[model samples]
Target: MNQLSTRTSPDTPWRLASLALAMLLSSLGTSIANVALPTLAREFAASFQAVQWVVLAYLLAVTTALVVVGRLGDQFGRRRLMLAGIGVFVLGSALAAASGSLAWLMAARVVQGLGAAVMMALSMALVGDAVPKSQSGRAMGLLGTMSAVGTALGPSLGGGLVAAFGWPAIFLATAALGLVAFAFAARHLPADARTAAPASFDLPGAALLASALAAYALAMTLPHGTPGTLRLALLLLSLVLAGAFFAVEVRSPAPLLRFALFREPGIGAGFAMAALVNVVAMTTLVVGPFHLARALGLAPAAVGLVMTAGPAVAALLGVPAGRAVDRFGSRRVLRLGLASMAAGCVGFAALPFSLGVPAYVLPLVLTTAGFAIFQAANNTAVVTAVAPERRGLVSALLTLARNLGLVTGASAMGAVFLAATGAASLAAADAAAIAKGTHVAFAVGGLLVAIAFAMTLAPVRAAAAVQGERA
Candidate 1:
């Protein structure tokens, strides 16, 4: 019998680097915006809700487009879509830098979000298209690690840029990075792989999915004091829409998500784990910083610095975590990661308002470490779960799941904190109330991690078995 080896070539390293660069920019837009927000508020003399729209608009665009663009790439060409996305992103950043009005800035942010969505969805998809199946996990892990690095660095970088040169600098920096990444990607990345099956755009499925997500996001954003009956009606209506969307997706000849892919235990479990982990990680990331800074009277830069600790730990541990996944099993790493995350959440929750910065930093480190390991293993599992031919779609679906969790977590946690702190009264900002709210948010976040842990141990066992059989 002939032997076939599965390994990436030396020349392929540049492609991986390009993928990392692309991933970093995609992530940078998300986290960096958080740092620029305070400056944006003061510069525009905007209300809190107006400044928040800067964040919300970017997320809405990215979340809505991530999966849809991925499917389009699969139908057309991955590299082609990536190039277009990058161009659009750079243009948006430039416009963002020049904007005098908050409305214009938000519009530019939406454009940038669309570009980011394409970059994020296609970068990993391209990696899957290029790398051998045996080495896919390592490649995906590296991409995830790069994303973690972007998340870690974004706060500090954004804050520094804002402090030094004002809010426009952040967008300028992003534009420069995007251009550099685009150059590298164009030079180093290979042509997109061909598909044997007939490919066509799934417009109906895409519209349905986008509408469902939009409705759900709107539902979550509605005011707490909204009439109870109206809220109930909206929730029920949203659920019905969700059901209709899922049915349409599953029945469509060219579904955005190949529902059958989840028939494989590994693929399904990996996606679920991805969603839960992101939900947990981001819930803390969003609420913790705001509570510490605006509510607790800490400096914005200090909050950013403190927030950097967790992601920095994750970035440092990423490669090692990937190696561990390859050596041991995803189940073990995932379980341990979730356990550590849960522990950190518990520790964070127990912290009182009087707790000092040093006390918070320690548990934050623990949380970051857990996030690093879980992300690496979870991503590795997703890449390895599918065959090479289907990796693009699978990667897109996984990325979509994670981003969806981010959008959901951000809104949910914000609402919880707002409710707890009585929306932070005009003058006081309510540190004690926010701290109490943060405790509740952290506990909920911990529950998410714990659920992921349990799912990994149980359902994922069968998934591992399936992967082994395929191997």
Candidate 2:
């Protein structure tokens, strides 16, 4: 077996490095385009709504195709699919950089997003394949750190590139990264050994699942002031499609999603905890800027600087968090991570609003650190719990859950803040109203984390109960 995880092969680190680059580039793709939206709008003379699709198209494409691409990796080969993904990403980036119209840019983004879907889904799966079981936590942590770095780097990097070279420079830079990743992958990534079992695809299930996911994402991300009717319709459409997909999946001989996997507590709980944690985690992004600017009276640049602290903390803690999982075990680390996040949430609610920026920064750092730990542990536990052949699908599910939570959080938590402020709009809210909203939003955030912590305890208790009965 050429499994890099079990050996000290010289290529191991290089192979992992390639995978890391893939992870970084995909995450960079996600956030980089966001900063370019205003530039795109001005350049194309398009409305904010039209330019927004440049970002939305990439995200929707990634969300929709994650599962399908992961399954394809398993059916074909991770290395092969990974190489193709890098190539496609490079191609898309080049196309985007050279785009002449708004429509062309959005289309390019879709192609980029498709490649990103494959890369994001497979990177973690490849971690399981490339790294040893004992060290999977750290590997997952490294990937998580790169993801944070990429995300953190995006806005600042994009802004600089746009200013220096033009909007195209951003895409061109990503294309360059893609090339680096591809060279490493092509040279070092080992091929998968042939499986004796016949390979087949669940085409119908794939199509239905992709459609359902895209619908849900669009519904969740509808532009502000969009009619509630349209959102509701999208939601219903997603549900119906999801239901149909499941119905088809159950009857498929080679199902894209294996229902039986979720029967395992580790797999099922891992997925649920991921979504729950992210929902709470995402609130920081949704509400932090508003609170910082409105409640504390910080300038735009100051708010951006303060907001950068969260991802910075996450990036710094990523490796250590993973090491903790390796040393103390994922379950212990999971509990600790959740507890920290819960406490941070409580701090937001408990601390006096008069404490100003310190109050916010302290709790934000703590919460972000906790999130880094939880993410590493959660991903490691879930990916390791699944069978090797199934890791690709499971990894995709894990990411899919996290993305769904972010989408849900952006819409739901934004409403939670707005409602708590007792104001109709952000501009109308006073400092007192902003303070009240922060307290309510984070209190709810803390409560949600508490729920996740409890969820983790359930399986352990159930196992103990079974053991006691056996005795």
Best by lDDT: 2
* Local distance difference test, each candidate: 0.77, 0.90
lDDT (Cα, tens digit) per residue for candidate 1, span 201-243? 7777788777776666655555445566775676677677778
lDDT of predicted model 2: 0.90
Please list the residue runs of candidate 2 whose C-alpha ends up more than 4 Å from where it truly belongs after superposition.
1-5, 462-471
Candidate 2, poorest ten consecutive residues by summed lDDT: 462-471
Could you give the C-alpha RMSD of every candidate to the true structure, in order shown? 3.7, 1.9
TM-score for each prediction? 0.86, 0.97
| RMSD (Cα, Å) of model 2 | 1.9
What is candidate 2's lDDT per residue for 141-222, written digit by digit as tens?
Answer: 9899999999999999999999999999999999999999999989887777688664688899999999999989999999
Model 1: lDDT equals 0.77
